[model samples]
Structure formats: structure tokens, C-alpha cells
Target: MPAPHGFEHLVRGDEIVILHHGVRAATLRGAKAADFLARIDTEDPQLLMARLTGNYRRGNERAARRHPRNQS
Candidate 1:
């Protein structure tokens, strides 16, 4: 089956990680994995974190860019 949306993994040495955007949302031990999965799958988490950090701009697509690698 396909992996859930917004779920991604990383491997380094002996550990594995799950991330949402660049945030370290979970590890193999699964402490906050449920909340992280729920948060990312159901919400615009990059936008959410931007809002929380007072970095959200109203209707600002410029921040998301238009380059192929940076496009939303």
C-alpha cells in the first residue's frame, strides 16, 4: 500500500526518522508519531508553523516560490 500523505522517512546510521517538511516529527520509537501524523495529514503544517511563529503572511505565495524544486 502507498504510504500516507505527508509521511516521509530518513535514515542515518542506526536510527530512522519521520519528518513533516523539515521538522523532525517522529522517530522509530513512536512517541509523538500519532500526533505528528494526524497534524500533517490533516493540516497545512508548514503554514501552521509559520502562523505559530508569527511568520505567516496573508496571501503570500512569494514565500513559496516558483522554482521547480521550491514550488508548492
Candidate 2:
């Protein structure tokens, strides 16, 4: 089967992969397989990287403090 909408197909070595919005979705060996499955699925890579790097915006600290879960 073909890849899903908004996905681009690519081949690396002996593996076939799908990229969704510039992020890796899945990879399969060989080229005779069906549709690829999403592995490291994510919506926004930038936001994910920002969160990982502890780069939240200035006001976000206050907002987090206001939340009940962050009180501790």
C-alpha cells in the first residue's frame, strides 16, 4: 500500500521510511511490504524539542506555577 496523506516516502540503505511533516514516522526493510506504521509519532517537532531542552517561554513559568500539579 501507499503511504498516508501528508507523508513523504524515502529509502535509506535497505530500509524504507516515511516522513510526516519533516519527522520520521516509520521504517521497513525491503520494498515489497505494505503500508508503513508510525513509530515515533509526534505533531510538532519544534515544540517537542523546546520542551526537552527546558526552553519554555518566560510567561510559561508563571502559568505552570498557577497550575495545581506544579504547586509541588
Candidate with maximal lDDT: 1
Candidate 1 global Cα RMSD:
10.7
Each candidate's root-mean-square deviation in Å? 10.7, 11.2
lDDT values for all models: 0.51, 0.49
Query: Which regions in candidate 1 have their CA more than 4 angstroms from the true location?
Result: 1-3, 29-72
Candidate 1: minimum summed lDDT over ten consecutive residues — where?
A: 1-10
Judged by whole-model lDDT over C-alpha atoms, candidate 2 comes out at 0.49
Q: Evaluated with TM-score, which candidate comes out highest?
A: 2
Model 2: CA > 4 A from native: 1-4, 31-72
Candidate 2 TM-score, C-alpha based: 0.35
Model 2: per-residue Cα lDDT over 17-61, one tens digit each:
655567775566643322232322444534433333344355566
